[model samples]
Target: MTITSQDQKVRGKNSYTFDEFLEKRSSLDWYKNDPILQKALKKYAGAKYEQIHNELQHFSSAVSSRWNPLAERAARPEARPSMLHFDAFNHRIDRVVRPMETHQLEKEVFGAGLFSSKMPAWESFAKRMLIHQLGEAGVACPLTCTIGLIALLEQYPNEDIPELEQILQHTKEGLEGDFAIGAQFMTEIQGGSDLPANVLEAVPDGKYYRLFGNKFFCSVAHADYSVVTAKISGTDKVSTFIVPSWLSGDKDKEKRNGYEINRIKWKMGTAELPTGEFQYNGALAYPVGPAGKGVAIAAGIVLTLSRLEIGIACAGFMLRAAREASLYGNFRTVFGKKVKDYPLSVRTLKKIEDAAHRTTAGAFKIYHQFLFLDQPLNAGIPVDQPIELRKQLFNLRELVLLQKICATNEGAEVLRDAISVFAGHGVMEEFSSLPRIFRDIVVNEQWEGPRNLLLTQIYRDIQRVTDWYPSADFVANVLEGASQETIDRFAEQLTDLLQRPVCGEVSEASMEAAEEWDVFCDSFFKAYQKIALEELQ
Candidate 1:
């Protein structure tokens, strides 16, 4: 046989998904395959199990077949939202116009109760996870923000604000076929995590206050209502507010509530979302909590909910990416044999599968505990036993932060590895959803809080306890279902790790401590995850 350049050019080609040729029935039923998910739901959903599971399966199919194409199309630069600074008459409308695809998905999703509180909190979050399997596609941030808004409304209902009832009714209950989407505008050029440094001004204006400042990151800028933080004129303390898109009685009209949509910010991922930097020009704002409690409320409630969603969404992304990769590899051929039969490919797929399993187990385990917290305070425990409350809170805080930082970062890498299995075809957006999912997961890594911030939060939170480090007890308690040997070993390991130096100074000396802190948190969470996965089984 003549060895020629043309002969060398014809080797085994790169493989993508066979999803198009396969019938709908051949598709993976995420609900059925995910026994860990089923097990977790068993701990919380009670009689609603079968119903929720069925609904999730249906939603999964819709995401894969129908909505995904539209959603992906919406991610195109030309398809995203743009501002209409004025109307034909030159009125300052300050409108952010999204594509019809985005509007359609929002309508379908809002009605599905993605952000509505009408359903039990656990079930609502479960549905969100299911939708997230389709990747953020720009919708995840808004949905989580809307859920955060609902949480705030439920926590601090204001009877003085006459419009609160209607906003709640529309957003939480989807009243009369109308649903309101919610957004959070917290980031400023000056203040990243330091809410106290926020300089946005809010002054008394009859019943509502008027806001005057600029927000550097206004995700879901077109949302019907926004949860914003601003300093009252008299003090520098930040307070939370529910700011409407339009004034009262201006429904379905062009009038904005005295704010300007500066421009949609270009982003690397989640292109379906319309994140912008905007300025408030006397925007009407109604305080949600007390003046000085803004930082506590925002951190304790809004950001916490967003971070939790990040954890769940991270797991879902890993599972979907792994499934696609595994499915493709099993049928794909390289050289003379099926790719899955190759030792190296098999090893890679197995590792990806294991990561998916670990993340799913940890996410649902934390989710079960979260559902308990959402119930009446001291749920299932006597009111006098306040220690139990502290234990659960400590465990949940560490779990959520750890999972968000680790899983999102790991999920992106999982997708990267998955794409490698596809060789050249992996980078081609038209060939598979991996490329898009890869970009989205990268964004998820830094969305709510970046890696370093979350690590600092977990370390600081663990260090703050005095009488007893509740996180130590919290970690021990969640690992209860595992073997005593496993539990005892982890207890010793965790205690030893907790004793390490916390990240403080910024010098080369401090940099050494920071690296050590990062490495320890990573190792500790991996161990916790092993126990969690065992418990799930």
Candidate 2:
């Protein structure tokens, strides 16, 4: 599937543009009555979550209407032969080309939106929308989020508010066609999760950087542009840049851009989304953020939002999987009883349902915290409150990280169990949505930040508090309103963990235990939660 400039046409019409959908939905009282979402938004008003939620139903409905038809058609036996070839091509475009374009637009719009709004609410809202609507496209969403953040850093310093707004508007307009597309640019042969260790080198030129590297697992091959991360020449620092298909000199031709798409990976899932490898040389590029700040900025700008979305997307996948499994279990019978009526099946369904609930609640809570920390809030807290508020913030990070890890890992397990209930039919592509969903969930595990990396961060945070256990006054202030029992429990747990000194030794057994540290870290978070609840009271 060659990507010629002529093939780049804005595909399908949106039922309503984002603004129109917002205006129409806001007029409905049903939206006003949504208590759960409303309460969640109030906790972090800066998230602009209400705005995102208000538009979500409409956006989801539109996307479903547009794509479900294709999805269903693609699954049809009669449509398979022709659609299979088309899908193969479509998958390439969705994985590679689409991600590139979306990333560019996200960079442009989000960058401008962040600084202009005077609040981080919009960031949270934007991230929520991406997670909810594009669960399968999680990889690209983060790339886009990162681009937007980089853009904000680069363009905002020189542009006024109005100019920035215009830039944002232009970016949103460009992104209108992106959801139907996809984005890609991850996985190098030498590095899977360790992006900092990537060997893709970028040589400095007058105004641009020249990128040469072999990129493994390019997800969306048909995109118009790609945000590639490469190591800067003569330095270990990683740098990010945008490479447009047309910018490499041939705007009209469909020739390869110094990169040959080797082959699409054969995978157990997400076949509809193509994943491939490519070798490219001297791909002209424009630098994103400062060269050295690439890794740090990527973490701040992209991974955080991405990690948050991974949690949200995992929740969505679990919800859908549970809903489908429950529906199927009710209708399908075994041994003269509905599957759902069986004790074991019922237990499975209940576990999936309960997990979905907890995951959603946890995600909403963290989303609010992220908004509060990043956005404008009423100032003038008493000086005495600083230590407590700082502690709350620290706990918030731990909670978010824990939720992201737990929800994603658990969501995948839930999906697997849900699919298992369907027996042989579950494994069949046409018989269940579970297969596609399962594939997508696999990617979510690695999205934003990998699970082990997050757990390590959580461990470091816990260690910090242990090293200098805050004074009694500080502790009391932080948990001022907490019950004595709850406070004592938290203190006891922290003390126990601190006393169990990590020898920091390298051994097979220690390595095995180290890998399981996240479980312990999660228990620590539970303790922090108890402390937080006391403060809230």
Candidate 3:
């Protein structure tokens, strides 16, 4: 049983060194190393390509070398954001206490002036895509919310409300070199996705409104301002408003604007972000648009932007998963051969890579269309617009939903498969980022709208617009570059499904149809993504 020196030498010689994998991973500059993304940037960024590319080079390198580590530190179990309900004086200041790394990460990310007027849309969009690779390291949700807020403000400029203008300036430009963070408080206990059912009251108070009710799910609870949705004081109509977290000069005093954070929700993923339940008691809120048109504005602008960003975020998640997984595969030796050389590993790696490329390509393609159209998303069909423009708008609307559902589903799948390549090392949180990214992707799948909800929404949407844009034509338009046979197959399937009910009173026929519709939608979006990938190639 005594160990021989010869056996010890043999054991040492066979020992595994993961230096190669670590070296390759650490050396990667997310932008410069990604030719696919580079090609995408060049193609879609158009005239702003050079400047944006240059900026991304520095930005992405910093993300890989600097921010990513901060994100890692922030994501640690002990570093999760917490609530401090009272200070030394026992005052009711619901402060969100976070780690130093999170604070630094948030400061630098907001300091980029991403939503500022001086930054081109393409630049901001590209920057966001890069940032999303770090997963929801707290900043991602805030970034998404802030952009939506800026878009809402820009959509409805109210010079009459000086506070509204000042809030916009704080977020869009900086106020004394400090960029404001934004959050959206929409989901109430009574309703989550059902915005119309919300009971939060927005009582008129002079020129401003006072919000009084509880927001059940408020992410980025520590934000400077929030885009709140509430029912008008006496009316049933849901309206959107911008509510500052603290009145002027109150932030330093830790005096919240008539609201208190009940508690921070223990989330399954995006642990670095602070999601809290809030009780609003006469919080001063400024209306964003017409009182009755809040639902439309929220859906058309705010929620739409968030869904679109989810697609982009999923693409970033897949890209990182695909890249790092491939690197690990190539470096690790198994059964006397590299992991990449195994047939199973090869197939798995290819699937992950393909999904990553398809998702990334589809995201860029959709964004390009969005930028080209340069129009606000209108809830329901815009029958007032010219036929072609209306059809294009409809196409964008449906495509956004399609991408959000499909990309998140596949991003989670891809990350799961990528983790498998590392075997036991993958599931260990400290060993890899894949587990955290995978969890974040799962959380994202439910955000904005879950799959079944979105599927039902799309079906209803098509039913509403069928007279103008037929289900068959919709298929053809969405999958523009796909083969005729492929388009016809989907078109026929969709047309048949339209005749049946996919939601409510689940019968055998409806159940069967629902299953078929779910499969058909996923397949159809993959076809569209393939076409996008072809165009990019």
Candidate 4:
């Protein structure tokens, strides 16, 4: 070893910079950079694919370059959303004060009118897929709620209610070029998923209803209107109502519609979005559907759409994780070799990539089928319909639940592994977007339905429909292209599991059956996802 002046200078030099990695990542266009997503879109989009391609490319680039930076900025500790209860006048406003970046991002994203009738369904779907890659940046939750609102209004049209029609127009097509944001406040102090347990009272007014009570877990709390679940003053059945955040002409005066945001929640993720508790005292509420049919309507249409969106969101989360981690793996060097060159890194990256691909394909495939069916989801199994239509609806229903639980579980796993590719830098909030995305994925896992709840639902759904649609035939239909051996194994496993109840007493056999059912659901969904991936190929 020579100790020359040049050698010593070279050894002491500082040349370690992540500039190259950062530049490549920042320069990427999410849609343009992803060949696999392009392939899936081409297969599923069909004739509309070319028409929407350029638009998606542009939107994807905007999401990666423009909106992503805004999301990052909005997610900073100093930029978190807060509640401003009053102004200089000392009057109650209950205003949600968010970062400028969030405001701008929401304005632009909503202005695009993704749910407008003029926008093609595939275009909106693909655009949502792209936007979700940013995670819940104070915009995604509102988009999701607005979607449910639009679906609910469309499902139950009331020609007599001019205000309801106007509300729909404002949300769906925009009013005076200002698109309204929507929220869903279904949770109460007593229940989260137990909708029937809600006790918020809706008293009949002149034409509309007045709500009086509280909503415990309200996300998108700053929205213009919220879809609230409450029971009529005399009725015990839970009903759905759309409550305006501000009465007409009151928004400018900062007058709230008889509801005060008690406090914003401190959540583990989606911190950029405001989740608040509300106390309502005679807030104006417009009923959406039949008085006693709120639970069914909300569960069937509104909640169903949210669950479907969660599956789509999970796909986007996994895609971003895989893409960014793969890039980092190839760029970062350790032990005198690139990270991707290591055997362990290669295997990990492959798993992330594969999961991302399959989840994405599964989402698009499910959406395509949904579009092809061109109908609203029934509250329960459509036993009254023709067997073929019943089977199709049944397939879609089970697929949505299966995709929700499985994709979210896999999405969280993929993101965790993807974070590892960055080594110590992975957990650093400012170092990469992976940590934020990872947290959002975990939240999504428990959002619409948790694993156990959905697992139980799936088992019960099968049991209820076994007489009309046999469990084995259902398996064969869902896992259509799979080998007979593969199909038969799952079918038989499902049949045997259905013999015992998934929710009965805690016996050894029941516990074993529950575990088996859980495992079976995951395995079955993964196989379905693989088939979806194959269809794209």
Candidate 5:
């Protein structure tokens, strides 16, 4: 943990010493008391307190090994650029996107039982790490694709496990080293989010499909391959295809595929990642999943997991921002005392802490639900209906949506408070990461389905129990002795929302109602907490 001359240079102006950094990195004290988390981590991550230090060391070494060589080569002032250029940025991203880093982490951590007993630990770990890594990026299209593929795999009961494994391995290898893959589906021209609404057509030739169309809002233009969702000939069904940067029978040798990058998007946040539009003729593609079911599959698998990850990422970003603010308040002086000494600052910090704790708790609660649904017992069955299994699945989905909504919304609020706590220092890029964190929060909100879209989904779930409330007994059990007044109030709101037809349709009125419904659900969750506390008592 010694601070070498090099370490001292890098750590300049940072509050923590090198030894403190090492200690913090090595310790799991942050998570130690959470038995559920400990069990899950040990089962999945293969890291106990005893081995966590060594494991962290290994992870650091791995990161340094790849970065060091490139750092050395670019040490020349002339070779290094002031800004990370597009090509260079793309190259760095491509290297990290591979399966070796992502999937390997999954297999080693969750799959290997670093914490507790769980099946398909690899999938679970991948999902977790994706959140940990890309949550900050905001609109990470490639990350969405990766999770979507896993979800799709889960749907095919008869798929060969080995074949699926091979596909994942191939995808990991292809994506490794790329930070973001370009998204070609959305367009100013296209009216809907549906890909079939896409005018892009792919011609079939043996196993490959040749694409011919222009797409807007491609997130990662520098990616090695573009997973384009296009319409296949002879049917109205939309299908996903993998189109590589380099392909056969192309006129522009250096250009490889016929696609030409049009322009990069200038956005409100996440400016570091490029979003672009492109047009191509005869770009080769390999089909993903079955034809026509692309939208359903995307929603169920890709969008859902991405939404969950966005929630998790928001929580992490909020943690980092809150920690920075808290540390600053402890040191910065105002009125002849540390700002933290002031009751107002203390209250703000406490609110951040409570929010963070709730977000983590909510996310973990959903993660457990994901584990439950993924278990073999629930496989092949529709997530809804079937008595016992139905209840578990229903709760799992509801909790996941709830956490996604709560974490993203509250994370944004916490980040804003963190910025306020730092005063002038927070807004400056040099003084704090608050600005970047704020951008990250905005991105999290936009990613997956937007807040209103998610709220509507939840309202639909609540409406499903029209005649009698859905999970009424469970709600009562959780809300027992909650002053009945609060319970009845929430029940009344729920009944009113359910009575109106708001599910399966997207309208301004419906969206407003959904937002109100979400508020009611929040109150309901608070009531449940009272019930849980009474049970513990």
Candidate 6:
């Protein structure tokens, strides 16, 4: 055989990519193999371990094969969903036209009861973890809203409100038939974080109300129902109402509710979910609870659940990024040597991997506490729990805010570090998921609560509750698995720090002191997270 010039050219050029033709996935028994995950499951789930484990494995496989591709395809901004404000003949119809990938992913994930709390505690959270690990694959946000709605439904079991019960049942039993999704339209054009300042107008109409206002950020805008807040024509109170996507009799004609999509938002991350602006034109709504309780209920129910899931989702993001980075580092070469062999590269990879593990450990630890505390809170008996339960629950509430801060911030940091290991290929969208996950984490950093808001909330909370809060005592409980010396070091420091509250009127000096305290609290929480990881082990 004679060797041709083209054959020589092909043989001389390298076409293989990093770790190609390899399985490049975690073991199928992901839940079974994770010691820390199982430990957390046992702490809460007990006898349901084996069942949950099998379920998690099945979900993991489906996510890896089906969701991964679907999400990647839909994540492109060009492939993003569009809102149809008119029917084929150009009549007004507020219908969201999403890629088929989104509908399939939602049906697969939510229909599998990923949004249900009715499953085993650990199992429910595990399914959510899987969905979130897909990183805003157009489903997690709506699923999150639905989860909050379910939690609120538990609080307000209104038998007479057939619509509430009907929609709630459909979301829970979506696996059976008629899968429903939920969303919240809280932030208005004038207010982003100021929930109480919303000025959406609501006029009484028989038993229902008609709303007219604009919502600034409406993710999952295609959801079947929205938990919206508006002020009654004569009152200053902000009240919550459940608004169906389409009016009761309109389903037959595919008619929409009394709202129109102003425009879909162009965001930096999580393009799979179509977040948009909307104008409510006398949209019929039903009250969720007593008037003027909307802001409180919105924060207590919807935002709380969203923040809790953000921590886990961010952790999931870190885990995925770290795994891919480590696998890449294992096989990649630089300067004529394997990248992982280099001391600096090894340290970076270790840092990313450790952060991923610690984040996962900390998130599960919170989920364990969340299951316990969320029950009493949802029951509206905040003061009814035993002192220890009360204390842990209170701490968990503050910690949920803190966890969102730390998990997402660290997820972004570790993901960037993971990208660094990939060198040139890291920034390329097609190379790996690092870039998209990086963007998702950045967006999540600002979701539910921002860093400054959360940090101040923690510091202020420590001060406000200092009289009853044994800061050292709470630290000791969470750090039960740490070394005695380690426990004493952070406990003593946090106790002393918590004791010094800024006294009297606000001034430049006190403001400066608060900033310094914020830095100290940041370190204090990182140490606490380290202790949480140890405890999980």
Winner on TM-score (3 vs 6): 3
Residue 120 displacement (Å), model 5? 8.1
After superposition on all CA atoms, how large is the RMSD of candidate 6? 3.0
Q: Where does candidate 6 stray beyond 4 Å?
A: 1-12, 19-22, 25-44, 116-118, 249-252, 378-386, 483-511
Candidate 2: Cα lDDT at 152: 39
Q: Whole-model lDDT, candidate 4? A: 0.91
Predicted candidate 3 versus true structure: per-residue lDDT over 1-537, tens digit per residue: 988998888775765577777877888999898888998888888898999998888899888999999998888999988999999999999999999999999999999999887998888887898899999998999999998898898888898898888888999898999999999989989788999999999899998889899999999999999999999878998999999999989999999999999999999999999999999999999999888787888888998999999999999999999899989888888789999999989999999999999999999999999989986565556678898888888899999999999999989899999999999999999878899999999999998989999999899989988877888888888888888999899999998888887875879988998998899889989998899888877
RMSD of 4: 2.2
Evaluate all candidate structures by whole-model CA lDDT and list the values in order.
0.77, 0.55, 0.90, 0.91, 0.54, 0.78
Model 2, 1-537: lDDT tens digits are 886666555445355333432343324332233333344444545455566566555544433443333443443323211112223344322123323333443343334333333435544453443334333432334334433443433432333223323334433333343322223364688777677888888888767777778888665555455656788899997776655544434544444455556666654444444566766677666666566656655555445555666666776677666666766777676788989999999999998876665555556556656656653121112245466575666555556677677777777888899898888878887665677677777766775567777777766666666433352332344344566775665566545544443335778755665655656655544444344322322
What's the count of clashing pairs in each model shown? 0, 17, 0, 0, 30, 0
TM-score for all predictions? Answer: 0.90, 0.69, 0.97, 0.97, 0.70, 0.92
Worst 10 residues of 6 by lDDT: 21-30
Choose 3 or 6, whichever is better by lDDT: 3
Tens digits of per-residue lDDT, candidate 1, 1-537, equal 787887677766565666552443245666666666677776667788777777777776676666776777776668767878888998877777778887777778777865554566557767777678777766777888887888888888789996877777767888788778899998898877777788899999987899998999888888999999998889878888999998766755678888888898877888777888878989999888777678778877888888888888888888877787887787678798987899999999988888888887788777778877763221112335477676667677777788888888888889999998888988988777788888888887878789999888877777666346544565568666666776676566556556655566578766766787787667667777776777655
* Least well predicted 10-residue stretch by lDDT in candidate 5: 91-100
lDDT of candidate 6 over 1-537, digit per residue (tens):
989998898876977664451365533334544565666666557778778877777777787777888988877767788877888897887677888888888877777865555577677787777667788889878888888887777677777677788877877766366678988889887888788899999999987899998899998888888889899889998988999888777865667788888888888888777888988898889888778888888887888889888988987787777777778887787789988999999999999878877778788877777776556444222665577776776677777877888888888899899999989989998777789888888998887868877776676666666566677776677667777887787777766655554432688766766666666656656776776677655
Clashing pairs for predicted structure model 1, backbone only: none
Q: Arrange candidates by TM-score, highest first: which order?
A: 4, 3, 6, 1, 5, 2
How many residue-pair clashes does candidate 3 contain? 0
Which 10-residue window in model 2 sums to the lowest lDDT?
77-86
Off by over 4 Å in 3: 1-15
